[model samples]
Target: MKRFSLNQATTRHWPMPDLVAGCVRAGVTGVGLWRENVQEYGVERSAALVRDAGLTVTSLCRGGFFQEPTWWDENRRAIDEAAALGAGTLVLVSGGLPPGSRDIDAARAHVGTAIGTLVPYALEAGVRLAIEPLHPMFSSDRCVVSTLKQALDLAAPYPHRAVGVAIDTYHLWWDDTVWEQIARAGREQRIACFQVADWLTPLPAGVLLGRGLPGTGCVELRRFREAVDAAGYAGPIEVEVFAEDVWSRPGDEVLAEALAGYRDHVAGPG
Candidate 1:
């Protein structure tokens, strides 16, 4: 329960104030926020609200879409927002290949270069950039960096403090090599964030929202948790499910279920 964090995406429709109050009531000391929600609620107001409630902003949702022409300006703004919100980490979703181009290698290289450009700004803002590798299914349109190894390779050139990796179970659960990579991340001190979500069969039509709460699907949730712990990552474990059914319920109910799942499956005695 101590390291549990309810990522804002788990309850997408809940208002910021209501979400903060519900987390406080549930004794959840940490939360992972989304840029859209923070901007809509006003960054300063959101910051103060969470601070006054004694909640920690575990990590901000995203700052990378290097394919966009405005990537520089947009990421800079994201860094500023994270700084104002007192978030120590900003997750980066390396965008997919450019239109009419299928060079995945080049896209990944661009992502590395882009992060290198932002290292100075991110360091100055006191926020770490966590490169998140989405599931390979999203390689064509969402994120070209599809494996933990690829994310690590991209981060290798930068200092761990300025650049690291976000390990999400939903994305990396299918890889047998992930265990070794997890250890490498810890050894290199590049584990900026750790998120949990189950992989469900009969994926939803909109694959992006196909994630399940911990213990609800086939992922070896406890094994992943123990592996990260053994790898020396003592950070918040954020449950970042993106299911429509979960989002349709009341925020409090969803939060309770998430906590139960985490306790029984991810954080329980091994």
Candidate 2:
């Protein structure tokens, strides 16, 4: 439980103050925040609120979408926000192929180049860029980087402290090569963040919000946890579920379930 974190998206409708208070009441010391939520609540205010409550902002969720024309400016703002929140890592969901273009190779090349452009700014801000590889299902419009190898490849040009990869179990669990890539990430010192969400079948309409909480689906959560630990990662394990059902519950109820799931599944002894 010491390393567990509740990502805000897991309970999307929970108000920031309520979430912070609830986490404090539950004895949770870490949280992964979403930019939209922080912006709505006022970034500085949100930072102060969390800090005053003695919670660590685990990682800010998202500064990628490199396909946007305004990506450069937007990413810089995201880095600044992360810095303000005292988050050490900024998660990047590298946007997919540009409109009407199918040249995946070129799109991926562009992502690496784009990150290179932001490395200096990110380093100066004291925030690490964590490239997250979404599942292949989102390859066309969400993220072109569909595997850990591709994410690591993109991070290769930058120093590990300036850029790294986010290992989310929900996305990488299907790849047989992930274990090997994870070891490589550890050796390269590029495992910047670790998020967990179980995979449920009969996926919901959009599929993006179909993730299950730990122990609620088929993923080998504990194995993934053990793998990252073996690979030398010592960061918080963020539970980032995105299901509507999970989000509909009260904040405290959802948090309790998340903690229990993490204990019984992700961090449990076999």
Candidate 3:
């Protein structure tokens, strides 16, 4: 229960103030935030709001997209925002190949080098860059770091406290070797965060908003929780769903349902 965190995406349209209140009322002490919303509501003000509500900012949604022209400046700003919000982790979504280019290996190499360039700033700002490997389905457009192994490899050159991997159930659930990789991540102290979003079939057109709630899809939610716990990770377990149906509902109602799902499927006997 202490590890449970409400990823703001679960209630995508919820206003920042309302989201904070809902989390408090639902006994949620941690939250994973997105950059746009924080910027819209004002980063310092939002940070103050969460602090006043006694909530912890577990991890900020994103700080990577190396393919973009303005990636360096954008990521630097992201790290500053996370630091301002008191979030120790800044999740990185390594962007895909550059436009009109088919060099995937080159794109991956660029991501690693890009992260290296940001290490000094990350360490100065006291934020750990948590590289998140999105699903292979997004490999062409969203992310090239499509496996936990690849993410860990990219983070290996830096100090674990400065660079780590973000483990998400939706992306890694299909891999048979994930358990071993989780163990390896723990051994290297490279696990910076953990996110949960069940996998549903017949993905939507963009495939970005197809995630289901815990216990509402095929992923073994408890298995992932147990595996991470076994690997000595006791960080926030963020429930991040990106579904039109989930977001269409009232934010409070969604928060309640998410908490229930966490208790049933993710908060099993330790």
Q: How many residue pairs clash in each candidate?
A: 0, 0, 0
TM-score of 1: 0.99
Provide the overall lDDT of each model, using Cα atoms, as 2-decimal numbers. 0.96, 0.96, 0.94
- Candidate 2 lDDT (Cα, 0 to 1): 0.96
Clashing pairs in 2: none
Weakest lDDT window of 10 consecutive positions for candidate 2: 201-210
Per-prediction TM-score: 0.99, 0.99, 0.98
lDDT of 3 by residue, 145-209 (tens): 99999999999999999999999999999999899999999999998999999988877775798
Model 3, global lDDT: 0.94
lDDT of 3 at 258: 91
- Give the lDDT of residue 66 in candidate 2: 92
Instruction: Please write out the lDDT profile of model 1 over residues 180-254, one tens digit for every residue.
Output: 999999999999999999998989998998899988999999999998999899999999999999999999999
Residue 225 of model 3: what lDDT? 90
Mind giving the per-residue lDDT tens digits that candidate 2 earns over 1-270?
A: 899999999989999999999999999999999999999999999999999999999999999999999999999999999999999999999998899999999999999999999999999999999999999999999899999999999999899999999999999999999999999999999999999999999889969988999999889999899999999999999999999999889999999999999999998898
Which 10-residue window of candidate 3 scores lowest in summed lDDT? 201-210
